[model samples]
Target chain A: MPQTHTFEMGMTCGSCANAARRVLEKMGEGITIDSIDVPTKRIVVTTEKSAEEVKTQLEKTGKAVSGVRITHIESH
Target chain B: LHQGKVSVEGMTCMSCVNHIQDTIGAKEGILNCTVSLQEKTATVIFDGSLWNGESVAEAIDDMGFESKLIS
Candidate 1:
């Protein structure tokens, strides 16, 4: 089952968003980015991976990831 | 030490420039990293034995931006 997680990140522009998207894409699978909103500094992704795992990957973009919120979870 | 110049793409603003500077600057062998958003370029000073222009460009590329060694 996949879980939808929303993360608060330090993204200022589209390039920052793109960086985040790329990092997640490089995760190789089981992760789908729903949206990256710079204004809200939020990134929403649905993935089978754990939040900690996803958070670690996001940190590679060199942006600060303040926290993660589990917005939706599929019923197993 | 060696100086390298790299052309970078996909940077939209100052934050992108700062991100590049901070990220690359913290890497081993990178003595200095200066990014110019207007010029779409980054000039790096690194240990010659550990890093070169091509490697710096590759590092930038790995950060999800399009980059190439200019000199």
Candidate 2:
């Protein structure tokens, strides 16, 4: 199953967005970045892992993460 | 070899420290990169002929963080 997770992160610029991408990329395979909106301070990611697990990984990037929510879940 | 310091703003945690260090240290001619979250600064050592403070500052800036060469 694939799950989509949305997180509220403090991102101010393109560089911040890129940094977030880089951090997620470092999380290795099985995770894909759906989008990062700096103005909205929202990051959407799709992965096989649980939202809680993904949130833990994202927090390692040193950004202030306000919240994480499971937006969608796919059985396939 | 050249050693310099740059002040960085908007770092929230040690992960930011590691990200900055790894990002800058990954560049060619960069010998070492140390980032201090508490000080909001980064110190780098690099080959002067192949790199400079401007390039390092630019790299940091490109990462969405504000950086200024202090030395």
Candidate 3:
């Protein structure tokens, strides 16, 4: 099953968003960045990993991750 | 040893501060790194012979935080 997770991060500019994207991309395979809304500071990612696990990884980027929500789950 | 300060952007909590401190502190030449969430800055003490402020700023940037050398 693949899950969609939404995280609220503290990103002040485009560079911050780009850095977050790079961090997630470097976290091995099976994780895809769905969208990053800079204004809202929300990032949505699709992956097999759980929301908690994803949150832990996201935190490594040095951005303040305020919240993580699992919005959707699909069986494959 | 040399002491320097860098301004950091986009930090909203202590975790962010801790992350920055840990990331920069882990570097070989870094002796101490203190990140302030309230000030959005980092004070680092390191071996000047082994590293420079630019590399420290780059490390913070690579970790997804914007950093600029203040001193």
Strongest candidate by TM-score:
1
* lDDT per residue (tens digit) for residues B1-71 in model 3: 99888888877766566667877898798999999878888899999998788778767866867788988
Cα error, residue A62 of model 3, in Å, equals 1.7
Question: Best DockQ goes to which candidate?
Answer: 1
Interface RMSD of 1: 1.1
Each candidate's DockQ: 0.71, 0.12, 0.26
For candidate 3, lDDT tens digit of each residue in A1-76?
7788899988766666777886788677999899998899999999998888877767767667977788776455
Between candidates 1 and 2, the lDDT winner: 1
State the lDDT at B14 in candidate 3: 69
Each model's TM-score for chain A is: 0.91, 0.86, 0.88
Between candidates 1 and 2, the TM-score winner = 1
Worst lDDT 10-window in candidate 1 chain B: B58-67
**Can you write out model 1's per-residue Cα lDDT over B1-71, one digit (the tens) per residue?**
89999998999989899899999999999999999999999999999999989999988877777899999
Order the candidate numbers by lDDT, best to worst: 1, 3, 2
**CAPRI-style quality class for the chain A–B interface of candidate 3:** acceptable
Give the lowest summed-lDDT range of ten residues in model 3 chain A.
A67-76
Instruction: Evaluate residue A55 in candidate 1 and report its C-alpha lDDT on the 0 to 100 scale.
Output: 90
Clashes of 2: 3
